[model samples]
Target: MKKILFLFVLGVFFFVPSLSVQAAEEFLYICGPCSRNFVPIAEDVIQELALEDNVHIKLVSCLGACTASPVVEFKGEIYGHMTKEKLFALLRSYFTL
Candidate 1:
């Protein structure tokens, strides 16, 4: 019984790291107001890049970029004044299929 439990723990330790990498691939966030104004653009860019699965899109309440109401957070960087073209260009690095 003890040996079985030890093997389970060891197996999980080896398997968890790969999951983290998949979790790390996520890369899109739109603030509350941004969502209403920019979701379509965001969706189009995702479809254009075929990143429906490769990247994650999150709708947040506020990213502290209200000065630039339509704000987007991507890969840990905050970008305001978001436009479809700019978003498309920014996402090229991550989704190049």
Candidate 2:
């Protein structure tokens, strides 16, 4: 019984590290008001770049940048006046796309 318990503990230790080694996923937050225009664009970019598994798109009511209606928050940095061209450029630089 003691040997079986020791083996179980050993197995858990090896398994947990593998779970932590997975690549971190990135989150893109788009403003609700601007989602009408930006969601599709974001979806297209992710699909085109085959980043569906690594990137996630979320819609929020606001990022408190209404003047810059189409705002997006990534990696805790807020970007305003978002455009499809700019998004492509940003992602390309970060993701090596």
Best by TM-score: 2
Q: Tell me the tens digit of each residue's lDDT in model 2 across 1-97.
A: 9999999999999988887855458999998875547898888988887888888999887788888857998888888988888888877777876
Which residue pairs in model 1 clash with each other?
none
The sequence of per-residue lDDT tens digits that candidate 1 reaches over residues 43-92 is 89888887887667788888988888679999889989888988888888
Off by over 4 Å in 1: 1-24
Predicted model with the maximum lDDT: 2
Poorest stretch of ten by lDDT in candidate 2: 16-25
The TM-score of predicted model 2 comes to 0.71
